[model samples]
Target: MRREAMRHRLTEEFFARHSTVVAPDLIGKLLVVGECSGRITEVEAYSGADDAASHAYRGRSSRNDVMFGPAGHIYVYFTYGMHFCANVVTDTVGVANAVLLRAIEPIDGIEQMVNRRGRSDNLTNGPGKLCQALGLDRSDNGASLLSGEIGIYDDSWPDRSAGRAIVVSPRIGITRAVDFPWRWQLAAERNERNERRRPGGSRTP
Candidate 1:
């Protein structure tokens, strides 16, 4: 019998949905940047025209044109004049909605990520930190997730059996839309108690 490797990749249709739908679902997905891989632990959603916090809220520009491209592409940009942050393009061809990959749990290439970040703590715990640890820069902007050096795979899916629960909170590291509870993360242990109290389990938003 021919051996077949288990594989699962999120399709463009998956990303073509609203950012809110894509954000929480991204948790537990695998982000593969070159040889480094991690399980997505956190993400924040940004609506293009509706969200004041979105880069394309006022319309696209030279720097944010990639955000308006087709879904399933990467949108990397420089920030703080010293660090790079990355986001995943979402919605339709003209829509600029996206989900910012806030943090991840390292699963592969730990040594390389540590070397890049020069420390282990918070290596991929923030937008900029995750980009740096994964060696993602502006050059990776507009890269297609379907065929590129960087890709997201659904190799592992978080569920009750995985002992994890999704938590939603307002986005961090931003002033605009700070009150919007659009951030999502995996609660490793707290969900057990929540699951017992909440009927029909938790739901993503």
Candidate 2:
């Protein structure tokens, strides 16, 4: 099951939608990078001109041009001068939308991640941290997820988080669009709240 899970790439249709729809749906999917993999735990959606928090809100720039590209691609960016944050570009050509990968639960290549970060706990609990742990940088920007060094896969379609339900809230650390409810994540506790709220609830195994 482990090997088979990483074989296919998610189709472009899976990402060619409004980021709000794609962000929450990305939870529990597997993000594969060569030998390293992790279950997507949290994401935040951003829209183009309509969203003041988005990089392309005002218009396109060299750094944000990737967001205007077709779906199923990455739009990595450097932030805070010392960290890189990874985002998945969504929507079709000419439309700018993306989902920031806020966190990931490690599923493979733990040793490499630990060695890169020099610690283990809370290694992938934030956008910058996950990028660091996953070895993502600006060079990975505009890469095609359908055929690139990185990709998001659905090895275990449903309940990949072992029955952990998904939760939604306003995006974090953003001044504008602070109350858009664009953030989605797999809740830590199991079966207490929001259970089976998502479409696929059955466990893969």
Candidate 3:
């Protein structure tokens, strides 16, 4: 990808919808953070109030305050008294919705990721792992994605994922709201089912 051609980033409007919609559209998109970047492959959506699994389900707090602020912002949090997880804040201001970035196929800065994660294989196969590999933590919680080290990008205008099939499944790792079926991913590259979801709205070369 050309440096000038990749200048366009996913704007606030791209993430202004419910996380469920944004989640699937994110597949095949590039997630860039400073020198590290990757192609987003999997994500899961969570919303406020109705979603029992969401941190904002019990209303806002210091930890989840960013989720209700705006669109296209990072909503990072620590978990399991150990690893951190990164989420993309979605929907409009005052609406608590986010998409958990579950997995990515490394596209840039692999050596840095390997060093951070202590291994190359499966470096970003899970949410916690992805965050660790990307060096994201609670400190990045409220940063805007528009013009910073963190941004979701894509190829030239109108061009998209070649209509790759998006696999829909129930979200994992949470006991509550486990059957919402909001998890979305590209159908494993080589899978040959006709099922497809076309993504619209992206940066231009």
| Best prediction by TM-score | 2
For model 1, the run of ten residues with the poorest summed lDDT: 190-199
Candidates, ranked, lDDT: 2, 3, 1
Name the 10 consecutive residues with the lowest summed lDDT in model 3.
192-201
Query: Mind sharing the TM-score for model 2?
Result: 0.88
**Which of the two candidates, 1 or 2, achieves a greater lDDT against the reference?**
2
TM-score per candidate: 0.86, 0.88, 0.87
Per-residue lDDT of candidate 3, residues 40-115 (tens digit): 8889999996999999999999899999999999999998999999999999999999999998878789999999
- Which lDDT tens digits does candidate 1 get at residues 1-205? 2211434777898889989999988888888888898888889999989999998999989999998999999999898899898899999989899999888888789899999999966678778888999999988999999876788887733322265678898888788988999989887454233111334666544
**Which 10-residue span in candidate 2 carries the lowest summed lDDT?**
190-199
Better of 2 and 3 by TM-score: 2
Q: Arrange candidates by TM-score, descending.
A: 2, 3, 1
Cα-based lDDT at residue 1, candidate 2? 52
